[model samples]
Target: MAWTKYQLFLAGLMLTTGSLNTLSAKWADTFSAEGCHGDKEHEFSHPFVQAVGMFLGEFSCLLVFHLLLCHDRRRPVPTVNPGQSFNPLLFLAPAMCDMTATSIMYVALSMTSASSFQMLRGAVIIFTGLLSVAFLGRRLKPSQWAGILITILGLIVVGMADFINLSGREEHRLSDIITGDLLIIMAQVIVAVQMVLEEKFVYKHDVHPLKAVGTEGLFGFTVLSLLLIPFYFIPVGEFTGNPRNVLEDALDAFCQIGQKPLIMLALLGNTVSIAFFNFAGISVTKEISATTRMVLDSLRTLVIWAVSLAVGWEQFMGLQVLGFLVLLSGTALYNGLHRPLLARIPCCAAWVLDDAEEQASAAERERLLANNRVVQAGDDA
Candidate 1:
């Protein structure tokens, strides 16, 4: 079928989303990767600092874009009026969720390899689907349910890979790896909740994605920064393997940022990339659907996987390969890409046939309602 302009635009946006996220992941890894980061690396290994940088970057991106590009009222862009659209306080809850999820993910990245971190995030789709069903009262189609099952199978495959890899490692290191993986999973859950809340509340208010993200950035930065004050005075927690005392680490991170040129650049780039990627992600959700955003995110995993391999951050692993393909396939299927190919197979054609019949019935019902309304109008006349 010929693509509509809308479809083409969405395709462009999807490409932007995938490319930017991939770049962000790579830059994030590079800043923290000891082997890949040159002689001039710093103590920015803390996820909290990275989260702070991203929050700052997002707010900057929104404000700069508004000043430079959005001054023209006729231009087609999501101009946000925070005063009229929604209460500013409403964004704080979701912002906290976003900060928690992002900070944990960054910490996980430091502990785990880049590819593992990316692949583990595939579980977010599974979480989102389950939450939608439970909290949003969303009923899934059979195909979507099938996709969910496949996704779960892929998650199992990936988890098995983690276990297999861990089995060969030292006891202490294995424990750390397991802990990091668990953190990544927890981060996914937090983000899933954030997505659902945004879908239910923020999206309904007609708040522009840019505005919503900016507001989130504002709140996240403020809350996270304030929360860090106690860390500066007292060691609330330590990074399991690394010698990361909260107060000292935070201070060291700032000093390193100022001292190292490459570290500063990486931090700046990561901040910018994250800001743009997040904006695109919100736009994808608002313009299309959250489901499509999740589907496209799998593309980012592919990018991170390839880059991680190229950079020697991760070695080739058969189980990860299998899990990635399965995860990607299931994601595509849920987005309705498998329908045409599956319909050609005799075994899977039944679902396609049923879907077509249902569509036909719905069309017939609408036609009858239109005719009945027309006849009723004539009788009234």
Candidate 2:
């Protein structure tokens, strides 16, 4: 189907805001602000507070959902069913997953370059596929397996590129980057679990996409906001640069945000961008295909990398470029977007399914796509 102007707008919005979500968070971490306990300057490393900003942005979706619902209610036929009932607490588990994954990724972002952070997120595709097989009773196509393997190789190449750039003098920096990248990959596993949980438990109720996102946001924000209290009391060896030498010094984070205008702006940008990103993402899935959404997400990674390079956040590496191309190829292949190319190959032709399998695959994709329209935005977890 040809995309309309509105649909194209949604696609662009999704790309722009999604990139901003990571970029802004990384930007927030770059500033040095006054410590809570002293006049000494400490870097803004408040990943938990940053996560709260994200959830707040997500909570804004609840406002938007209500506005849209009211508008729909005025129409002769309402798009949202008022009678649809599911306990709001159903979101608790997925919200917990979102909280953990997002907080860890933000911590990782504080240590790594923004470009690397964006690229590494593609690892979610691998985790999501494997988890689907294990828990969802799904069988993979051969092409999908090829894609997973290629993606793994791409990840290794990216990590190697980071390692090669490290000077002996920068050994500590190297350790941070390596640790950050590994943490990001681990977080993707949590994200995959969130997706599976949403598909199995939440989408089955046919909940509205906006409501799903907003409800999850509410739960995530409420729970994590409370956790920040206990986190202040917990001590950690690393990230002791803050005033309290604790895991997450909430008071220190607040003091930092209050002191730095740029930091506050970045956090605000991160929050606002996420809300719009979810809206555009859901619209893209509804108006176009999930395959298109996947393609656009890949483009977002490129955009992020280019912006990072343009802004001198990191130096350009030829090896990293090669890795990105391989990663993109794998992403496309896994989504079956490379079927035409596969069909053209002599030996690999069988991987392109016959009519019967093709029909089944198409049906399965449609069903998943329908669920995705409901669950996609919330998976921003």
Candidate 3:
């Protein structure tokens, strides 16, 4: 059956959303525990597993793209033709940016609490908005700006609550927490830059988004794998020399994988869901507007949060709930108040079609009137 773009989009959305929710529920407990207590010793023993999971996630994304390409092979997903030569240089900027951002995020998560990770990641929206305006020359209406501010405020409120809970807790090291938060924020900034650069590249070169993603993933995995190689070889004596301790740490790291089947399932589910969600989102954007897609994406985040809370990965703290509502409200306002106003301005084919339809109807009436005149003249004659 021939599928309308909307149908394809909805299918992608369902697949992505379901997988993501399942992944989130599974990973919540594992990430919560590991994010709180994971250390270098535990990391060293099971280095391969860590590397494997990272590799698998990237490979999985690539696999999804390949599947998409195969399904749509009759017509290539739109992309720039590199003219029969592979350009490694073309991949460098995006790959480096992604690698840097992802590496920092992973390291940061290891240092901070999962709750902090969730709350702080919201800052990405703010960074993305600012980057769009500055780098991409996109203008944001005042209401859209307000929405960004509201999201930031909501994150601040959530962070403050986390801070209060951590206050006077000697077990929770303040410096480490701050370091992790800083790393996460830096990652967000890098990601914002990466997204902007990616858009420019795709539009300027007419690069197919899927192909671009595949190339970016390949480069990212290569770069990260290379960089991590040194870490794997670090002498155990330098960090903690006791052979037993080293062996124990390695066992513990391996145990981390086995300890939480549910969390692993959640992580895996999230990976699959994101792949499908992105494909659907791209399809929808082709049919609709990016602003519309962004609105939907925000709604998806709320869905994730709701599911996370419902599954008990997170407690329904009053402030956290309030923050989530505020964030969501901001997104709604941006969509309802700002985007509709922008859409009214004459621009794309969709608007042009409306104007054309009006002109066509008027022309048809004029033709009928002229025809009637000819008939009347014949009668008089």
User: What overall lDDT goes with each candidate model?
Assistant: 0.71, 0.88, 0.58
Q: How many Å off is the CA of 21 in candidate 2?
A: 0.7
Ranking by TM-score: 2, 1, 3
Comparing 2 and 3 on lDDT, the stronger one = 2
**TM-score of each candidate?**
0.77, 0.90, 0.65
User: What would the TM-score be for candidate 1 when compared with the true structure?
Assistant: 0.77
Q: Candidate 2 lDDT, tens digit per residue, 1-381? A: 677899989999999999999889988888998966666888888899999989999988988988988999899978866447899888999999999999999989988888888888889889999999999888888878999999998999888888886756477788898999999999999999999999888887868788899999999899999999999899887764576678888888778878887888999999999999999998899999887899888998888898888988899899999989988988887888987676788876776658338769888997999788769767875
Tens-digit lDDT track for model 3 on 1-381? 475777656755844564364334335324422321443322222322243344345445556666655666656464523323345467679777877776566556555555556556667768888989988887676667888888778777766665565568675456556777778778889988887876665444545565566567677667665654454445555222223333113344434556645545655654555455656666667765665566566555556556666766655567766776676666655454443454666665465455447658877986898689889989999
Instruction: Kindly report which residue stretches of model 2 are placed more than 4 angstroms away from their true locations once superposed.
Output: 80-83, 340-381
User: What stretches of model 1 exceed 4 Å from their correct place?
Assistant: 1-43, 68-70, 74-84, 236-244, 279-295, 342-381
lDDT of 1: 0.71
- The C-alpha RMSD of each candidate to the native structure, in angstroms, is 6.8, 5.5, 12.2
Superposed Cα RMSD, model 2: 5.5
Worst 10 residues of 1 by lDDT: 33-42
- In terms of lDDT, the best-performing candidate is 2
